[model samples]
Target: MSDKRRAFESPADLARPITQPVLRRPAATTMGAVLVVLRVLAGVWWLLALTFSWNDVLLDDLGLGDEPDFQALGNDVKEAISSGILNTVLIVGGIVLVIELLFALLVFRGVNWARVVVMVFATLSIIGSFVGWWLGGQEITVHTTLVTLALDILVLLALSSQGARAYARRPRERRARGSVA
Candidate 1:
């Protein structure tokens, strides 16, 4: 067979095992494993926030009392929830959680896109978290937000490393070749 045709051989014919050194060095594996743990924890927090908020809004039904405007906003939110606005919130929150989980899984797989995606998402979340903490007027939330922001910054920095950048770029390279007519 010609060399070009040999390259396109059936899977059965190409089944010979070829030993290769591990691509990820020990340090990279250790660092990546730590990042995966952090990513999973963050993902869980966001996922739980969605469900927790949904449950609180659904069961407690605190529209006015929870608002800064007290009675007026509370009454308005209550009315809105009663009128199905709460459903919209739940739907949106669910979508966000699902996307978060998808990113988490990708991070677990050491996918480069997950790093960029999660970094952007985490940054936005840090802003939202701070805003929510401030608006919440709760000391505990403020503390939590600070810790979360710190962790997110670390994750972004780690994902910006040479190894992470390479992982993310591999797919782009494949696409570039695939796109050539």
Candidate 2:
């Protein structure tokens, strides 16, 4: 018989292994829990700012309070404040509240990027607070300043903990394993 080899192909050649990546939840750590609490506090801070302080600061302090030019507009000024200006302030405040809650949840989930983001924001807040106190000569009570600074420092420390770092890397580790043969 003439030596001829037909194309050797099996059904296995057509079938490919489908790799489904498994999702692993990192072990919960004390540092992570502390971060969660801090994040929740941050969210609450925003909630209070929006619900209580926004109107007072926007309408009374910064708005038409002592503006002589606004006095000429009179009734129109009242109408504008009642309609567009107040609505815009409320809208902006609501957006800030939403962002605060979302970031807090992300940080609580041990997202490394979220941790960095929150730390950067906290640092900025601290700087802004100090600058406002110094430059604006705003009379901020020692207790209020100290409490805010303490919360920010604690959040920074908790996010920098060894356990938090490991927890953040777990997703990357899973991805690495899934990519290998």
Candidate 3:
């Protein structure tokens, strides 16, 4: 009778060196890529919130509320100042998010450089957030920044795993099927 499945491998076969690279992507790599995507989404969510209701968050911006002149300014002037600040933040922040997305795409494709970039940046961001909170008394609220911070930490961990690193560093397979690939 013909069998579709091959018999179990012998010890010699198992000990033989691997000539071909694996085609399957590791779970760690895929998870890291997905985490980065989610992190970018969190940034977009807050950016949109700030863009639309910036007036609410600007009451204490740069201590402008403490300025007698700023307080005395008409509602129109106050709104313009708030809008400017929010627009600046959104413009710069959006650019950063887009860059993150590009690297994430490469990571999903098993690119080692992109994985390194994502992990390094995530580490730096986590360190910076703690430094800001410690030195600058930056608030760490559970609603927004904390959630993103957790994601950053998770991304760093996922991309740094051995499975993810090995998958990224493995030899790339040639696309042409007829030749020795």
Candidate 4:
């Protein structure tokens, strides 16, 4: 047998770093940044909403105070339960924000699956917003609605741009090339 080893059997070949192709388009970079910013803004919005509305909306207005079993409980016990519930909500919300931020980062890295996920999330958010407006029976503020809609639209537009599409496609093309060879 020949002393020469096959390229695939070489340790160096296996250890070689696979470099990601750089995104050359400005639009792709901008879209990635915008998606991340949108996620950050969403996290901030949730924080503010929870901070401002937790006590009044959750405990008082929602009649957490008036639950028949809660009525018989001592004030200290009631306060503890309410505090526990609020803490749980905050923790869960924080987890969600973190997850959203991670997904945003993935999108920024030109992952096509991340782009699809973000698009799906944006579409769901838009649909949920409309459904809430119609079924919630609460007055919807124009400013909030407009801002939400604008962000969703902009995200969709940016991700759908030709430059962004090309950036996302690069990895798939690379994979195909490797597989063919």
lDDT per residue as tens, model 3, 1-181: 7755355656675445455575788898999999999999998998988777676576655667688989999999887887788889989999999999999999999988899889889889899889989998888887647988999999987997756866787777568867763
> Rank order by TM-score, top first?
3, 4, 2, 1
lDDT of 2 at 45: 65
Q: Where does candidate 2 stray beyond 4 Å? A: 1-60, 142-148, 171-181
What order do you get sorting by lDDT, best first? 3, 4, 2, 1
Q: Per-residue CA lDDT of candidate 4, range 1-181, in tens?
A: 8976454445564344445654474575467657657766866786678667777766676797668887898989977887888788778878877777777777777777787787788788778888877898644564356566667767877876645755765644435554756
For each candidate, give its TM-score against the true structure: 0.48, 0.61, 0.76, 0.70
Q: lDDT for every model?
A: 0.57, 0.60, 0.83, 0.69
Candidate 2 residue-wise lDDT, 1-181, digit = tens: 6666335535564233324322443333345445545555655565566556654665586776567776677686666665676567657766765676676677666676777777787788778878988998865564245566666667667765544555554434345555864
Give the distance in Å from residue 53's predicted Cα in candidate 4 to where it truly belongs.
Answer: 3.2
- Candidate 3 has an lDDT of 0.83
For model 1, residues 46-119, the per-residue Cα lDDT tens digits are 65675557546544655544555544556566666554755666567667656666665676556655767777
Clashes of each: 2, 0, 0, 0
As a TM-score, model 1 comes out at: 0.48
**Preferred candidate (lDDT higher): 2 or 3:** 3
Candidate 1 ranges with C-alpha deviation above 4 Å: 1-22, 25-63, 66-87, 127-144, 170-181
